[model samples]
Target: MKLTKEIQDSIPFQYANDVRSGKITTGKYIKLAVDRFFQWIDSAEKDGYHIDHNSGMHVIEFFEFFLKHTKGPLANEPVILSPYQQFTFYNIFAWKDENGNRRINHVYEKVARKNGKTAGLAGLGLYCQSFDDEEGAEIYAAATKEMQAKVCWEQAHDFVFKGIGLRKIGFKNTQREIRFEHRERNGNVRKGNFRFLGGDSKTQDGLNPSLAIIDEYHAHKDDGVKEVLESAMGARQNPITYVITTAGFNTTSVCKAAEDVYKDILDGHKIDNHTFIMIHDLDEGDDWEDPANWVKANPNLNVSVSMKYLKREYTKAINQPSKIPNFKTKHLNMWVDAAETRIEDHIWMKSDKKIKLANFIKNGCAGALDMSSTTDLSSLGLVSNPDENGIIDILPLLFCPSDTIDKRSKEDKVPYRFWKDLKLKDYIDFEGTDFSEDNFWEKLPVLIATHGNQIDYATIEDYLQKLEAIFLPKWWEYDRWSATQLVQNMTEKEIEMHPFSQTISHFSEPTKQFEKHAYAAEFRHGGHPILRWMMSGVQAYEDPNENIRYVKNRSTKRIDGIIMTIMALAGTITPEEDNNESKYNHEEFTL
Candidate 1:
């Protein structure tokens, strides 16, 4: 029951202990993987499952014993699993069901670029084909293209050399297949086969796979190949779908979709006890420049992945903006587009300007409305103190249809699932009727009040009614397309509505001011995750006149919240535009 010094050195055990003891730096999903793993281990006895330590150790030790390191400084030496690698191996092979089937039926790992994934997966493929107890095991290395699929297959093929895992192995080099004569304890012999399957193959039938290793899942446009190959597993009593790759650029890729679902499982939004997930990457708050953060994603940092080479590349990336995206993607394991990005994450994370609605309600503030077309998002952006100090605080309320959360989340890759309220986090599902004139006035304020059951609806309405009693604005602004019933209602209240055209001439100056205020400590957003994501996704172009305009490109994120904030800031900067004298009257208001 106790871990000896030798056992304590195991990558899987060490990582499990480090995560349980809170000793290692990790991200949101990494924490989920570690916690869920231990939870499974603790509940195994009660679930009629058994922990086969020998079976798990057999995998890790097998890889270390016979797998040769192919193309590194340690080339030709046996492949020794790092702590993170050992953790993965331990999870996939250690637990067995009541009928002695492997508990982990599938594993999807979103790891950094160079942690020896190809070599490791090749070793596992060889083990499944030649060493596992199963008779006639079929293993495959699959990908979208034939050339891409052959990389892992070639690695597995190279392992057929003498002294490798499956010593005296038979390799049909022309056909790209490896066969082993596995002997049973009863002196009966069976043929275990491993081969490469290209995505160009017409049909994926006739494969009774025990293990399918999918490499570079991010490169695949969809999960077509994975689905077809996984479909071949029904006949096998114990089968596994293994996916391994780095972060991808295209948000619509199946890897991206699966990545989100895995995060959901990690965060306890859903449960999938059979699949093992681990995302090796730096946590959100960790400084990417720090060498220590490199180890967060690259578990093999100093070993197979050189610290000196990474430091050199990091220095270059810091100095050259063009190289930064690729460096972050490959080394730091962060998902970033190589295209132009406007709002910097480091700047947004440092902002500290979130104010309570009650405090802002006491003071008067101007509001801007952006009700995107009927099928999209509707948002209200509030900016306080337009005249004297110029936007002392900000209050944003975002609304989306209850039905389109998943569609929007997938399309933009933003965490809309977390922005359902006026809070700076995720979203709340809106269940009311369409955002009509009557509905907007009624539903918008309630979303803010009901978050975490902090305040009731009537109380928040009562507080806002007091604000309406003394509501005045230096100016109220809105995008032209948002001339809704709500816009008419606010105008009828005599708070002048300025229909600002979204043009370079009109918004160029305020947009620049907004950027300046953020970096110069003049403006602050409450460090909302969705806001940060929107800021990073903004695609802007600068004209020859030194003015800027936002242009939508092929990026995989939405900028709705940031757009609303900009509209709010537009009114805040034009303080002298108040034309109505009776705007400051204690206006009667009701929901």
Candidate 2:
């Protein structure tokens, strides 16, 4: 397609073609030239003057005005323009079909920061509001916040009020909408009004937008907001949806979604039905210090941005390496790691410890149980016996309730089912063989009587009482072994003496509180490797202060494992006590 005189004059067309043809080696230079040209167009248009070839605003204004009026009758499709619109229109809107059907296109762009994104988009807004073919066209420039929305609105407002020829076109900016009235051959008519709508589903709903621009689209907290805006576009035939933003924090975010769509277009994952342009710094490695990487990532250098500003930021970032990622990605318009490490290696290493599974099993075990109410996992902590030397062993068990079962029932896994699946029932040996599955209640008294002297069972109730009486105040003072042992004792079957209700009500608060304190304190202390591991594996949703009220956040496998170990220690304690008692009885008789 032959370039129009106006297009040839616009710097974007020249730089874009140069970049496409490999003549322009620097992406930043091309971006700057393009952005500068667009800014000039915006300035001229705002002043109510026509941008001719010599003026450099001609091509920019022409592309913007073309998009506004290109949709003949099907103007409501969410239309997005790409590669700053002018470069993309050659393939999409510049030519007429043999059948005379003008190709309608949707455009999307992913560009880095500080390269005239707002300015270029504002120019488009001006053209759409002033010269678009649709009369009374409802145009919207949206962002996550009202302030962001206003930024676009203000730009458009300035262009309409200040652009050279736009004033004569009767462009008027009201409090909320920009309106223009003009005379056609048929009759006097009014057209080109744009409204600013902040990014929210409820705010954009029910509006028939002829054109919509989603600025910084990735920063939106929820995808639903974007979806709502897209849904609103269905009312406009051949409507344009312009998604322009930089990379987001993670691949899961909105920016990544748009990036993926762009990639799919490039990779033939989808038909190239829409116009997509992705101009990003191609810096590949972790090395941000390399000037080569900087050049690759920032394509707006020396034009819109001064080299001095880049050097200053680079020096500042280098002085504090911690700020490199943010500076490189946000300011330099590069893709870098946005998710900072939540756990430092040194902190984790300082708290790490190793123990053999055999040794863990040999120790008298106590359990800490974290039950769940959702499909989230239940956790168990099995604390090892404290030897005469005051050492504690700990093991963790996790049980994740099945999502399907929980979802279908709207209930957590049945306790009996969990016990059966984990073989916990087998590990928990009842003293009597006469125990009945259905009538376990009838045999419970006998089992309790037989094991009464052998085991110490504490229900959740016993655990809480012990916490309030002995654990809370001394929690931090306890060594790793003592803390683990304490938690184990609380989980024992012998402590299970209950009107089960008594245990449930009393254990609820304090137990939760202890868990919370213990979890955070252990996290802070950076010791108690086993406790740290258990805590790391714990997915509890207890308040920061309470552990007993904690609900499991993930699968219960780890905590449940820990709880079983604790239970083992509690149940086995009786044997040791009984042996000691027998020895004393024999000595007394002999005496």
Candidate 3:
């Protein structure tokens, strides 16, 4: 392929080529992203996009020539971008559409700690405020707390005082903000401001931003800052929201949700043409102990992040197992929970087989309902009797309020609505059965959104009656605390409801069995994404008596599906002394 001068000179392009040619090592997702970049470049013209080499180069020049380092040994020195840093800036500024407008309006960047993420992005923020030529431009560095919000802003704030060129512009450096005074062509004075916006700030009204840099987004408990910044950018011609962060412990955070979206774009699952994503994380099964693999996450490995420093951290993590999760999260750029997870991702993924649920209809199943929170996700998990191969198939039906799906989607960063639209056929097999011939069980929705803000108990009762008539589940288990009313209503409908105690002793055996089935690949979950995500968040908590119960790493994380699955598994565990292994009756059931 013929390469333009811009492509040939681009550090990111070279990095991509090297990664593709095996000259450099990286995670599969990073490799996939770079590959996508090259593919897009090759077909960009036909796709109504163009690479404005000069525009990207101009931004790079501003960084190297104007910005100066404010701290460490490089204090007062001109900012020199590492190859990966250059790649980041080039991609963001280079991509353009048919109208010569910036193609990328948003960018999500994930890098390991000590990679100069704040400093580099701070320079970009300053550039957007001054050089972007937007009238009365507003630039914000936002975070959940005031201290965190000031981190990036301080870096940019210091650059103005240190950089001679920026200093000459007479920037008003206040205690909380920096401003550039200017007048329009009509002789009207306008002041462009750059400020740090904390979540507790008084008000964000009447604000119009040209660039909003969200730093350390993973630490955010909610989407308040992000939501405000995004909604305020509607009036700008080419506004950009730059989210930059390292890996964090909270799997249920808004940052992790944003990561999922960027990941989908990289994986070719979904498309958002205006968003640019570059993530650096350890690949699946990558040995974090290996120094050779460290560069995959820390792209500026030997530059901004020293090998000696990382080695010291790794050694500490090795000697003290408690520090391992922190090392992985901060140094290796992996989103690990502070507590160790019960099931490894590889082990859990092994049960993702396409088993036909319709074929097991005559085989009686057991169910468990988890309605722990009326305002959050509720699940009804069904488990079939072990087949001749000792494999148990699972079907989990999830529910949430219709009115809160979108709200929760934005707040929790999970796609509740998308999951609700998914059907059984999307994940499991439905062939060679009467149920497959029509839009019945085969097309049964996996997640249903009930009307209103609170879960409608009547809707759950109706569904239970339908399931009992069709599948004839032997019994249904319910949590004693939250399901008393539901159980009472179901009992009136002739459905056997058992109160399941939510205790360590009660859950231990079934939890152990669930793990056993998972490890042996005897549990078929059909690779449901929601279940997989919940499984990822699960951590085993052990009592002093050696009894164990399922718990989520974070309180905000929803593991109702996993809990219900464990409860349902209890009913399928037949005693060894009972020679009659067939738990289900041969009699057919009718709806």
Candidate lDDT values, in order:
0.67, 0.46, 0.79
Which number leads on lDDT? Answer: 3
Summing lDDT over every window of 10 consecutive residues in candidate 3, give the lowest-scoring window: 582-591
- Kindly give the number of clashing pairs for every candidate: 9, 84, 0
lDDT of 2 at 514: 34
lDDT ranking, best first: 3, 1, 2
- Per-residue C-alpha lDDT of model 3 across residues 363-462, encoded as one tens digit per residue: 6678888995777889887899887788888988888889888888887677887887888677877665555655666556767888999898788887
TM-score of each: 0.56, 0.49, 0.58
Native-to-model Cα distance after best TM-score fit, residue 416 in candidate 1, in Å:
37
Candidate 1 lDDT over residue span 20-70, tens digit each:
676876666777788887777678778767667778889888877777766
Q: Which 10 consecutive residues of model 1 have the lowest summed lDDT? A: 582-591
Q: Pick the candidate with the highest TM-score.
A: 3
Please state the error at residue 161 of candidate 1 in Å: 2.6
Q: lDDT score of model 1?
A: 0.67
Lowest summed lDDT across 10 adjacent residues in model 2 is found at 444-453
